[model samples]
Target: MRRDELLDAAEGLLCDQGSAALTLAAVADRAGVSKGGLLYHYGSKEALIKGMVERLIEDFDELVAAQPGETYTERYVGATMAAVRSGRLRRWAVVTSASGNLFLLAPLREAMTRWHREGLSEEPDPLASQIARLACEGLWDVASHDPGLNSEDDLQALEARLRALLASTA
Candidate 1:
């Protein structure tokens, strides 16, 4: 619970105040923990960022696991849509964290590679699954930068189209 609170504090800083404000002292202050406590969990800024990435991936994985779908592709698409709708902080972290440190991306890269591999493994048509997966990721990128670009209806339509495309190939 304390760990999660620290992570939440860190993300709050990242999302609300930008990456510059995400210092260990700031996170410790925001989390109402001592700097020592923060360090006990995350020894450095890089470690904290890596923890944040791991948490984000865990959160997304849980969402994907909980989703109801006939196939991994469907669950993945649903999870991607759900994430795009509610993952502004995550998107921001992914977009902004890399600039601070390239090493921060190693975990993200590994996770994405694994997800891409697993997301298409069960599909009848790997090409269609790949396209849908890429489209979903692209949609996430666009929505992260400009949420206003797609209305609720637009998102629903896009999901439906992607689902249809997946179903067609299935």
Candidate 2:
């Protein structure tokens, strides 16, 4: 709980202020914890950013788990749509941009790689499924910055289209 609180503070700092302002002292102050207390949870800025990345992954996983879908592609689409609707993906874009550290993005990359593998395994038409996944992911990234594209109706339509593609391939 304390860890999450600290991470919450870090995320708030990242969102409210740019990465340049995300100092340990700033997070400690923002979290209402002593610097030592913050240190106890996260030793460095890198660790805190890493924690934020992990939290994002967990958030996405929860969305995926809650989605009712028969295949990984379906679940992925559902989760991405949820992320866009909830503005979580937009916040993630801010977090990733603020960090400016490729090393920190490794965990995100690894999770995506794993998800791609799982998505491929569940679909008989791997090419279609892969295309759907890529397209969905592309939309997810783009929607974070484009409100018109992220609207509920638009996202629903996009999901339907992706599902249709998958269905056609199957």
Which regions of candidate 2 are displaced past 4 Å? none
Q: Against the true structure, candidate 1 has what lDDT?
A: 0.81
Q: Give candidate 1 misplaced runs (Cα > 4 Å).
A: 88-99
Which lDDT tens digits does candidate 2 get at residues 1-170? 99989988887887788788889999999999999999898889888888889888888888888998778888888888877777787668767876778999999999898878885865869889889889978987787677465557777888899889888877
- What is residue 116's positional error in candidate 2, in angstroms? 1.4
Tens digits of per-residue lDDT for model 1, 17-128: 7877878999999999999999999999888888888777888789889888888888888998888778653645443463467688777788788778894766889999
Q: What is the lDDT for 128 in model 2? A: 90
The TM-score, computed over Cα atoms with residue i paired to residue i, of candidate 2 is: 0.92
Question: TM-scores of the models, in the given order?
Answer: 0.92, 0.92
- Give the Å error, residue 133, model 1: 0.2
Error of 2 at 101 (Å): 3.0
lDDT of 2: 0.84
